[model samples]
Each structure stands twice: as structure tokens, then as C-alpha cells.
Target: MTTSTHEKRPNILLITVDQMRYDCLSLLGHPVIETPNLDELARTGVRFDHAYSATPTCVPARAAIFTGQKQTSHGRVGYQDRVPWNYDKTLPGELAKSGYHTQCVGKMHVYPARSLLGFHNVILHDGYLHHNRNKHSVPMQEHFNEVDDYLPWLRAQVPGADLLDLGLDCNASTVARPWALPEHLHPTNWTVSQSIDFLRRRDPSKPFFLWMSFVRPHSPLDPPQAYFDLYKDADFPDPVIGDWAMKEDPQGSGLNPVTSKGLVPKRRLRNAMAAYYALITHIDHQIGRFLQVLEEYGERNNTIIMFTSDHGELMGDHHLFRKTLPYEGSTHIPFIVNDPGDCLGLDKGNVVSEIIELRDIMPSLLEAASTEIPDTVEGNSIWDLARTNGKALERPWREYLHGEHAQGMDSTQWITDGWEKYIWYSQTGEEQFFNLAEDPGELHNLMDSPQAQERIHYWRSVLIQELEGREEGYVQDGRLVVGRKPVNILAHLRSNE
Candidate 1:
């Protein structure tokens, strides 16, 4: 461990993307999507092929990330607000207490918008939240104002720039087009600019923790023309559809978030995906810019850089557009940890395939700073796995990750061990199992296969144990429960948000 002296303390840079998928990076063998910077970032450290966002949405996923605890403990079992984030030991809060100056540069999906959750300063940019701007939305309380930091800056930089010039609905629609404004005025760029500025203004006397959250590859599919052009004619892979997923096939209409969901035309799907890939590439370039800044400060070798996302986007997979599902495309997120080689005395280029979650971020970062991990935290530090390349550490490392999302959108629960996955739809009492190793697209349901019945029962029992005491009635009489009320933010906000 480093001494308490200021010079010995290293900086921690935690970067999170909004809705990027785990397989988007080129290093991960994505066919056409180019994420060169992120690929380079991965080469510098360890990347988890199986990292997941337990809640797989903006609000609840971030709750687990900042708290290092399960969604149940955080009281954000689904997409919820106004439940009151009463946790005492948060990621940044703990880092702050450890004498490290903490700053969040973008996207705190927390209630009240400016709750800080415990950052010293936050340059907020919660990209186009339906609840925040829609006056007709169920308003539970006064919030931190609907005006985000990026809009004001964009307007100031380009006098005639309009946020909605392309006629895209930031909340619902999945329209794809080149950005009307210059690339420099984009929110992704703005986030990095503000993060770089924080590095310049931070106190040099203490180790600093900066959370750079990018909101892109999510919606408002507007990339710069160059980026859009790069993928406009690219041979992108078709959406992988499972035989059992024919119910959600792209034969429906109206592209929106929750209500008018299920499949769009093939042309529209390709357009949305092309724009999405462009956004990922653009964000990767901006991250490259931020890393350049770190190198300039000669702090690159003294800082631990971690990259991840709140959750993955479905991107037309299983005919789904947004988050809140048990599918791999929705819950899987890319995670990379690049510790300065000499600084942390850690190995490099290790790829860990164990199942991990958003909750692991806090305890891992806390461990990096020599801060004690709180008993309230449930996530295992990735450091243990990184040190041994997934062979070391103690007992009770989760064999599988339990994932769920609370929204009327497929109120689902799933358990995956990175090889096989089992899902339970609470409302329909439906069960789906997939041998992920053989069917990464989740094309074939193996639940009814006589050969996989034993594995199905094993995972079902695991999920039952996971939800035993939950009020959602997910479990009862020592058996799996069904037909419970699905998780929904709209429903929760109608009462308290």
C-alpha cells in the first residue's frame, strides 16, 4: 500500500459511458464498429468480457455503481427515484473522506439532479431524461432544473445551434442523422472538456478522483457527418434473432421508448445502429483526448484509469431498443481497468472472463485508494481477479450475476455464469434458458430441452435464493414466485418518484 503522504497517493479516473454494449469495441471482435481508443485502453490493462449492469438502466444501474451494493440494498430494485439515497458509504463519498478530492463531470441520474451523492462538484448532463423535462411527467418534487450544462455551453459556442435541429426526440425516438451542430459542441466532447478542466484545476496536494460519464450510444442517434459517413455504408451485422424471440420480431411500428415498442423496419434498424456505432467511435476519440491530457500532466503513470458503462443497449437485438431486459445485449457492459504499471505494481493485458457487475466499481476503486471497503458493499474488488488473472482470491466470488430491471419493459430477472443464462419474466411466469457459450445471440431456448433441465433447475434455484425476501413476490413458499407487479419508474413516481 502507498503511504498516506500526498505524493504516494495515486489518482483514480473512472469513466462511464451511457449505453455502450460490451461487444462494441474492435478488440472484442466487433465486425464493423471501430473503437480504436477503447481497444488501446484495453491493451493497457485488463478488460472484463462479462461485466454487467444488474439493473441495466440509467438510474438503478448507477445506484449500484456508486453504492457498491445490490439494487435491493440501495432501494432502487427497479428504475426509481425519491426513495431517498440514504446510503452513508458511496464511491465518491468514501474517496472524499479518504482525503481524495472527488469530482463528477457528467450524468448523475440521481434524484434532485444535483444531489451530488457526494461529489465536490458536478457538471451535470443527464442526456434527455423523459421525466426531468416533460412537465406532463409525474412530478414528485422540485429538481435541479431542466437546463443541463451542455446546452448552455453549446448555445454560447454556436449562436444558432439548436439541440433538436435534426427533429429527433431525445427521450423516445431512435432517429439517426448527422449532428447539425459542430462536433466540438457535442455533449460527449463537452463532458471530456469539463473533465480535462477539472484535472487542470484540481488540488495538487491530494490524490483526486474524477468520474467522467459520457452519454452517448444511447439515443438521439446524431453523430458528426464524418462519423456517420464512416459507417453509413459499412457492412454491419444484422440483428440476431432467436427462434423463441419471434414474438418481438421487427414487424411492429412506432419507434419510442416504452409504449410503442417492438421492432422497426430493417432500414431503420441499420440506420439506428450505424449512428450508434459512430457515437461509440466519437466517444472513444474524446476519451483519447482526455488520456492525452493525463499524459501531458505526467500523471498517466500515476493514475488508475477505469472505463465502463451504466448498461448496454439492445440495439434492435431481440427487437428491443432500450434497456431493462434479461438479454445479453441489454445487461452486458464493457469494463476496463488500466492501472499505471509501476504505480500499482500490477500486471497488464489480462482479460478476465468472470461475471462482474456495476456494483464492483466502488469497492475496487476504494481498494485502489487504500480506503477500507465498507461492510455494506457487496461487490468483490476486481483487483483480486486482476492480480491473479481470475485465479486468486477468497471463496464466495459470485458464480453468476443476478440481473433485473424494473420498468414495465419486460420486468425480468436473469442469472448468468458467462456460459449459460436463465431468465424469469415475473409477470408472465415465463422461463427462458440459453446456452450462451453456444448461442451468444440467445437464439435457441434450452429450457425445455431434456438435456439442460438440470442446469435450468440449478439457475432457477439460484435466482429464487437471490429474491427470497424481496417484497416483489419474486419468491414464496421456498419456491419461485410469479405474476408479481413488474418494476416501473412511472408507477413508482406516481407516488414518490
Candidate 2:
């Protein structure tokens, strides 16, 4: 086969699904949710089982991805609004610089509401963001409605269609229900529709970088009625309960009784899980259609498709509702890299167990384009390890990745080695450790166990050193301080370094 330059410099398709759990995909071995398209992609690609969202929330996690920096360097350790995402170099910007036509077709929680952030074109749809609608958002501009693209298109479709009509909160992770609108109007379908249209009108001369970011399986938990009915009657396993969860379990989902956390009826919990699973399956189907459109355009065989998520969903685990926790359910995310044989080829069907963070995405994709990764990137390209041609390669990066999310008393910090995970409740200074190899569900808390004493001490010492430069008083005089607020960003820490 004669190699063509187009085959060598393949088009990049980066697909990100919102709030998807690592284990929920059928490819990843979840028993209930059938995500055939995603599973097929995994079968043909390298699946990184240990990939994570370091900060484990929408905004902060994406900052790590788009900038190739950890939460600390990116100055978004946890979720915050209008934090000025003024990165000097961004993933899309860098790709655009390298002659790739970059386009984003879904959720981009970038501040300023309309900031391009380097993408040449962005068909934005960020579900429902409360912060951007605030008066203080996009500071100095001062208008309340930041004007999102989706709602207007939706209103155009239904004349007076309102996504919030059925009282759905996009941030509510513990919620689930059937979509009141037609399936065609669903956000998942709309995103794919826009991507298909972009494909039909895309400039064919350049190798494109497309981000089909799906904002589903996140919330409103609203799947189409047909998708919702697929699992509404199914049985489900009990939520994973840790020994210490009883004290911290939430009573309800925010203020709504219709959806909530804590000890709820098993039937109601199953229904929520069913809807969540159904949303994923729905997205997976749309992905299949998008791939078909790519095939029609003769782009599928030559494109390098990378699928991941911003963070993950807690989905009733430990009586927890959403992300912003250090639990595996919240931080662990799906990462699949489908490098076509004609493209920048990598090992096929490789299940890499090495700990990989979301920060690695920028460098990896740049490497895929045969472009230079900026020296400022904190993560090295995984492509180096992956190009072993069908063999699993365990190249050394960080021995463990540090992650944290701010939630007042529920604020957390943790480090994981894919084998073992150590979590610290930053506020209370309480700790929990799990041998993730044996307990993937995180049901056991080994904090008090004598067997884990040495490991606990080791990780604790690491955290102490890690927090030394924090301005939040999390550490005081070389000791981990209890009851201190876990501040999201230490803006001055960079200058001190």
C-alpha cells in the first residue's frame, strides 16, 4: 500500500462525553449499560483503564486537558467561575497553529462565554451553566444572559421550548428523568447533528481537529422517552457503601425531593441509574451515526478518534450524588485512543493500566498530529508508550497522580497508583485508603486498618509536602491542618517557585 501524506497526517476527532463514569461503558465491563459504539471503539483502540480527571469537575478538569497542565499550575484546583482561562497556549490553539483546522461542537466551559480560546470555530452547547448567567460572569461585560448557542436553537425548533420546563437541574447528579421533548431535539442528538453538518461543510484541504463534546450522562439525566424506557424496569446492584459513609451521606439532591442522595428507596435509586445508563447508550448511538457521516465523507478510515470525558459521575456511590470527590466513581474516567493503522498508528486493543491524567491529552493529541508539544505542557505524550505496535507498554511518568476538588467539608485530596488509592478529606483531616486492585467499588475504608498503616503514613507525608505552599492554611508549620478551608488556587505559588 502506497502511503499518502493525508494518511500520515490524519484528521483528529476528539470526542468527550460529559460526566461519564469509567466503569459504566459496556466496553469497560459494566453489566447493565450497553454502549456498543463506544465498546467497538475500545475494541479497536487502546483503552487507558487508569485515566483520571485530576480535579474531577467540569471546569477544572477541562482546564487540565486543554492546557496540558495539572490543576495547580492551571490555577483551577477546583471549580470556580470567571477564573480567567487566559492560558498562553491552548490545545486547540496549538493545533490551529500547526495548520490544523480546529473546531469544537459541544460543551466547552471556557470563561467569557464567547472566548474562542484558540478554536477557529466552536458550535458551543454547555447544557445549563449557572455561573455564566450571573452578573459577575465575564466581568465588566455585566449582562446577565451570556447568550448560549443551544437554547436559542432549541427555542427556534420548538418556538417556546425551554430545557428547564420540567424543572431539571443540569448540575444535579442524583437526578434522572425522561426527556419531555422529541428525541431529535435532545442535546446529545443536536451535538451530533451539528458535527455532521460541519463535516459536510468542512474545508477538505486541511487536516481538521474536531471535538464532538457530548453533554449528557451528566444531568438533567434526561434521556429520550424511548431510551429511558429501555432500563426503567431493570434491576440494579446496591450502591457501594463504605464503612464511614453513614456519617457523611447526603439527605437529598440539593433541594429537590424528586431526586436526591443518602438512604433512598432501592427502586428509586435503580430508576436513576437506569436513566443515566440509558443516556450513555443514547450518546453512544449518536456517536455511531456521527462515525457513519464521517464514513460517507471518506474520513473515518483516516481519522484518529480519541474519546474521553471531563470528569465522572458518583451516581449514588457511598450515598454521594456527583463529582468533586476523590472516589474512583468521581475521578476515574474513560480514555480511548483509536489510532487508525493508516494514521499515527498505536498498539491496538491495549488496555494500559498505568496512571494517566486528563492533562496528558493535549500533548498526546499534538504528538498525533506530528506537531511540537509546547514545553509548558506538564504531561508527556502517551503516544510514545502506545506506539509499541500492539503490545502494552508501561512507560514511567508520575508514579501516582494527585487530585482534589473543593466542597467545603467534603473537600478532598487523593493520590492513586491504579493499584491503591489514598484519599484525605481536607477539611476534617480524615483519611480513607483503598486497594483499588481488589476493591474497585471502594466499599472498604482501610484508614483504621493496621495492615495499611505504613502506606497511610507514606501518602500522608506526601500530602503534607504537597500542601506546604498552599495559602489556604491546609498546612501550618509543616503539619496538615484540620478544619481549614481547601482553597482552589494558590495564585502566588507559581511565582514563589
Model 1 spans with C-alpha error above 4 angstroms: 1-4, 136-147, 159-162, 247-251, 254-261, 487-497
Q: Which residue pairs show backbone clashes in model 2? A: 253-260
Give the per-residue lDDT of model 2 (tens digit) for 148-177. Answer: 678778888888777678677876555567
Alpha-carbon error at 87 in model 1, in Å? 2.3
Instruction: Please provide, for model 1 over 347-380, each residue's C-alpha lDDT reduced to its tens digit, 9 standing for 90 to 100.
Output: 6888887889989999989988989998989998
- RMSD in Å for model 2: 3.2
Tell me the spans in candidate 2 whose CA falls farther than 4 Å from its real position.
1-7, 134-146, 247-261, 389-395, 492-497
Give the range of the ten consecutive residues with the poorest summed lDDT in model 2.
251-260
